[model samples]
Target: MTSASSAGPRRVVVVRHAETVDNAARIWQGHKDTELSERGRAQVQAAAPHLAAYAPSLIVSSDLRRAAATAEAIAGLTGLEVRLDPRLREVHVGEWQGLHADEVRERYPEVVAALDRGEDAPRGVTGETMAQVAHRAGTALREISDELEAGETAVVVAHGVSARVAVSDLVGLDQDVSDAVFRGLGNCHWIELVEAGKSYSEATRWRISGWNLGPWNV
Candidate 1:
């Protein structure tokens, strides 16, 4: 999209939730709610201060507990109430939920093969596509951006996949391009984006100010 003037928030921070019990155990957690691990609580404590340094006015997050917990940490630090939204949740894996990664690889080798070949395969045969994920996640992000004033900032806490997909949408990059360019979103890590356009649309754009920042380097 074109880089015009910002009509909404000036800056935005996209954060991935910290480690969950499922995440630690390599379980496939798409739309399957799980609690944060002990390490995740500590991670939240560590990352919250860095996020608070931005002085963001709002904190939005997925309704899932994993993301909610992370958002709560920032809220505690910044005194901003957490806004829960289901749109920010992770991609639905259909039957893949509760299954381990290895199980998925074994049971859905065809779908996994397609995805591994860079094809946009539907997750778990009956789940949403990457495009669908981008659509819902992008819409949520746009709404959040629209709610802010020019000088305001907001933190969006979501899952790893949705976070990157939303960035690709806002930055006008192809999903495949972002899929290849962006690496892992480590637990409690975040990316900062500066709004460079008025409103969120095909003629608007955002600049990535920082990426993959965590407590140590934040």
Candidate 2:
């Protein structure tokens, strides 16, 4: 609600990549280079056309294959090239990368408890905090926002956590409280945000017009 003018608000459609095998097994995929599961491909097939209908001027994605695959699906329909950016990668969960949720809980109860208590704790003992993830992911999002021409939309395909955290950061939510506000984006689901005029602070410069949209929930 920050921008009053019609022309200044840029449309950014942030899509989470489809599910991966690791995701199906509830394993942490942080920085893991995993391809989309079969269902993920089906999800992309279902959602890509809807995203392409936005006629985005740019299609950017995390370098991870799952995100890249989703971006490519939309790109194929729009004739736009997918731009890979490592900065848009998922939060790195360190040694917890290959572990399932229960395994993590059993191995790192304190860390899990800290997070359960809403602390911005480091993941997997040596991994990055949500704030750290927000820094890099938010920077990438802002850059994408700046790259769009007036009234042009851009589609960014990213991992679930990265997409949520980046959007939360841009909209001025603290890492500690963001989780309470935003759940992980469903596979191939998307959030649509409109840029407020530059008059607002960075924390409030983005306004979410739609969130968690997809064939399943739209």
lDDT of 2 by residue, 1-218 (tens): 23334555678999999988898989998998997899989999999889999889999999999899989999999999999999899999988998998999899999999988888888888998888889999999988887776678999998888898898877887766667766778999999998664454443356888889998777
* Per-candidate count of clashing residue pairs (backbone under 3 Å): 4, 0
Shift of residue 174 alpha carbon in model 1, Å: 0.9
Q: Look at candidate 1 and give me any clashing residue pairs.
A: 5-197, 5-198, 6-197, 7-198
Error of 2 at 55 (Å): 0.5
Residues 1-218, candidate 1, lDDT per residue (tens digit)?
22334345478899999999999999989999899999999999999998988898899999999999899999998888999999999998888889999999999999999999988788988888889999999899988877767668899999999998987787678999777888868999998988664444545457787889998876
TM-score, structure 2 vs. true: 0.91
Off by over 4 Å in 2: 1-8, 196-204
